[model samples]
Target chain A: METQLFVQIALNGWNQQVARAEKFFNGLSDEAFQRTVGAGKNRIIYLYGHLTAYHDMLKETLGLGTATHSFLVNDFLKNADDVKANMPSVAELRQYWAEVHNELNVLFAALPAEDWFKRHNAMTDEDFKKDPTRNRLSVLLSRTNHIAYHFGQLVLA
Target chain B: METQLFVQIALNGWNQQVARAEKFFNGLSDEAFQRTVGAGKNRIIYLYGHLTAYHDMLKETLGLGTATHSFLVNDFLKNADDVKANMPSVAELRQYWAEVHNELNVLFAALPAEDWFKRHNAMTDEDFKKDPTRNRLSVLLSRTNHIAYHFGQLVLA
Candidate 1:
């Protein structure tokens, strides 16, 4: 595969994952959003916020855009997937999600193909050289899988 | 993007999803496999079987291979997602999962790039002509997302 085409497919696949989420969530009732699934006992509202929080963090992490949910990192990232009382409501989280999704898509659309191969997140030159797979495009691709994981769970919810 | 490279990357991505599922399912304990999520409601075994059955059908639908579980098609396919009393044991389902997964991977690996562009499953030539998006490669790509969706749910299990 030419590097350009390879990157484009990855980018389109990533966007498709996002679109799947929007399609899955579109027109879902508010009661449905608050529904809980699994023995873990988390509500869909919490998962939606958690998903949006990750995207918000990813925007900053990949330098595609700025972080929109600096407040959510502690509650959502590395935290157990349990329901938290303080999570933003489904409506607010959806707005945050749409914002991050729009900006990230724009960033991806505007990105030069070469930029996909650039260093990402907090990695220094030496860090990136040692693990070239940690590049910006890799971040996009991995986050795509991450989003898919949550969407699967949502369907069950 | 050259069509060949685009198809190649798509193929590799499809296999990567399989590898991820194998890695996730490899060492799961029998108890864990049967463990119920959604508050003792849905069992992992049912979900596993459902996932495998989908692949078995996809192999035939994409013309990659024959169906390994015609018997399972009636129960697991369009039926409800709930756990069933008559469902196969975890080991038996695992065997089916492995068989379908292996054969499907082999089929995908050997698929000609041009075939990926051909019409798929129930789509007639006339339908494919109207909406080329319903081609074989599109099926593989969509199923890749399907696998990811289930994997997300499995991790919770």
Candidate 2:
């Protein structure tokens, strides 16, 4: 019930989901990663890139630091997959995935417990004050669910 | 953050996901609901039933009440879908989904804020003491992610 404990629960859930996704993608072959979940649906590669791009932004969103993989934003986040678009190699994206999450892990670990209750950069102070639920921990919780949701789709790939 | 606020965030996340999924499924035609996420993967109807069955069990898991749709457990929860299996009609499962969640909304609304910190029926007292994060709110948080995960898959249908 303490703030530290509450923050720990949110962080643990985020870590658990990130681990699950990492393991799932790590075990996938490059060919399998290229396969779409279904005909004409987003490819596994795109989802992997999408997740990496989103988490890369989480650094800024959480007020931890700037995004390390900002270049991926236009390709993966701004647009749906276009088979002809220039994109990173699966190998490159794999490395980005590791680096981004590893960096996030360290940043997240060093975050003071009380900071989790503070508003992230994405929210206006006025909006966050009106609904305190839109704090940093809430972003982590929502993004944790976001990862799980995508992981669910990835499993069907 | 206070315990009441933390609990509200978790419950609100759960409600938001449930509403998203409910809207998605409600808008789907029976033909679309019957379509599989991928070849030989879960059908949307199966996921709907599975979610209903899982939420039905949440009543007991949260120690709010016994499962009202106990009969759905074996078909929807314990076993993978079989084309030949005697499953509920799509219409029938749709009705169950609404009923189960509606009942859960009432039960969840009545739960005291402090009670969210208590261990549910699923965990032993010693286990809960060892890791208080495994409380009723934790279960809700995990299940909220579970729904989001499946909803991610369902959208591909």
Candidate 3:
């Protein structure tokens, strides 16, 4: 296949997979989602919350947000216990997760092909030097699999 | 699109994207691939290595290999320094990378749609309550974007 055609097909396929995966996730019950198979384990609710946080982070890094980027995985892990302590009821959590999904759709749709290689603005932290253009998308794309990976685990669990 | 059609398209697209990304990565300088940036500070080389590891891991998980399944990310991280310590001259790394890419093609070509979600006879350590079936093809479909993500990063960097 021609390169452009290949890319188009891949992008279309991604949208379809996301739609299906989202629906599957939405179908879970709060009890099923919240069940801790083992103590301090990753319940469905926790996984969704983590997905929500990371997607938001991707949005911020891609410069798709009006607000500054504040969500860090470290911060989430640091506050993991606290976040889980106040875990929303399953229904409420699903609603939040769906919103995050919608946000991802919007951000991805708005991504300009021309900006695909532009370096991102310098991160405030000296430690971070993310090339503004491509790393955001790369990291974002990796997280999509990350979500799928964990979701697969949750389904199996 | 219909669910089956969507999955098929995803599979094709993923396969194509990995090829495109692999070519793009292979053309880059070792220094370029090794530079650290972004929120995660991951380099291009690191991503290339991880992709290779995950491809092999998926093959094993799907029972495509006689070799026992190895810890995916763990082994890569553990051997990260040694793997990079005497980095093959750029030419050698590219050759190695191409071999993996060829292996990916072979793996993809052999995968049947029906086998995408089939559970393996050997139980995985994952906490699955039941032996659920999943298309092994789904993982490959999802990983296409994962490779693209890093490719985008390399371009921007």
Give the fraction of reference interface contacts each candidate recovers.
Answer: 0.45, 0.74, 0.02
Determine the backbone clash count of candidate 2.
Answer: 1
lDDT of 2 by residue, A29-104 (tens): 8888878877888899999999999999999998899999999999999999999999999999999999999999
Off by over 4 Å in 1: A1-20, A23-35, A60-63, A81-91, A111-141, B1-12, B29-32, B81-85, B112-134
Q: Please write out the lDDT profile of model 1 over residues A1-157, one tens digit for every residue.
A: 2455446657767778888888877768877876765554567776677777888888778877788677776666767555444666667777888887887778878888777777886799999777665677666666777778788777777
For model 3 the local lDDT of residue B35 reads: 62
DockQ of candidate 2? 0.80
- TM-score for each model: 0.74, 0.96, 0.45
- Per-residue lDDT over B1-157 for candidate 3, one digit per residue giving the tens place of the 0 to 100 score: 1223334545555665676767777677777876642434455666666666666566666677632223335534446523345444556556656666576567656766445545553465363224232234444555665565455444434
Q: What DockQ does each prediction reach against the true complex?
A: 0.33, 0.80, 0.04
Q: What is the interface RMSD of candidate 3, in Å?
A: 12.9
User: For candidate 1, what is the DockQ-based docking class?
Assistant: acceptable
Quality class of the docking in candidate 2, CAPRI style = high
Query: Which of candidates 2 and 3 is the stronger one according to DockQ?
Result: 2
DockQ of 1: 0.33
- Name the top TM-score candidate: 2
- Of the true interface contacts, the fraction found in model 1 is 0.45
Scanning candidate 1 chain A in windows of ten residues, the lowest lDDT window is A1-10
* lDDT per residue (tens digit) for residues B1-157 in model 2: 3888888888889999999999999998888877888888988888999999999999999899989899998888999987777988889988999999999989888988888888989889999889988888888899999999999888887
Rank candidates, lDDT, best first.
Answer: 2, 1, 3
